[model samples]
Target: MAHKRFAQIPMSKRMRELCKEEDFAFLKSQPDQDQSSEESKLQESQTQKKLERDHRQEERQLNEQERQREIEEQKKVQCHAEKEEKWKSHVAELAVKREAIHAKLHRLREFRDFQKKVLLQDLDPGSTNETINHLLMRL
Candidate 1:
């Protein structure tokens, strides 16, 4: 029954009851040591929580920066596509203008040939058809 009662007490308190006076003085300070150890553990837990919060904030900032970079890249790609389309349109317009200029130059050449034929006919009213054809061929 006495053993059962001793077992009911905590191990440290049991040691305190059995210890000499000098050893009891040392055991009496055990609670203060336990309190200081608990305080250190609490400070360590708070520091760990603060570090975790800082790490989470850094991750969020990095994610936002990556998102911004992707957006800027998309904008650059869109702008480049727009510029390429405009360049192709301008090239097509220039081709059309070139063809129109070529057609005008061909018409001008035909008109000049017709004027030369008329001038030759006026200059030689008695010329034979064969002679006029031969002169035109030489021209």
Candidate 2:
């Protein structure tokens, strides 16, 4: 039982506690164990390197994605601002057109009133000057 417990300790620790003759004997008996331990250490180092490489690759991909997202956001904002500017300009153009149309309508109204007055005077030439003055005043 004590030997089993002793064997459970690591080989390096066991060698430290053992006499030189016993250590030599143990090493001779476990040549394959030492080789297997070296192989395991090599495997662990390779695995650690692979994990670090994968982590760096993942970080690069995340940073690239964030950069793309920022670019896309900038494009969206620029597009929105351009669209807003176009809409504002369109509204301003419409307001200008509306004002021009109102001015033309006012001119047409004045011309219509003048024509009506001329037609009335021609249709009733005998209308008194006082009556014409009263009608013009009412207009």
Best by TM-score: 2
lDDT of prediction 1: 0.80
- Kindly list the per-residue Cα lDDT of model 2 for residues 45-137, writing each as its tens digit: 999999999999999999999999999999999999999999999999999999999999999889767856885767677777677657666
Note each model's CA RMSD in angstroms.
Answer: 12.9, 10.7
Clashes of 1: 0
Lowest-lDDT window of 10 residues in candidate 2? 1-10
Model 1: pairs clashing at backbone N, Cα or C within 3 Å: none
Q: Write down the lDDT that model 2 would get.
A: 0.80
* lDDT, candidate 1, 1-139, per-residue tens: 1346456666675565565565667766555644787787887899999999999999999999999999999999999999999999999999999999999999988976796679676876777767766766686
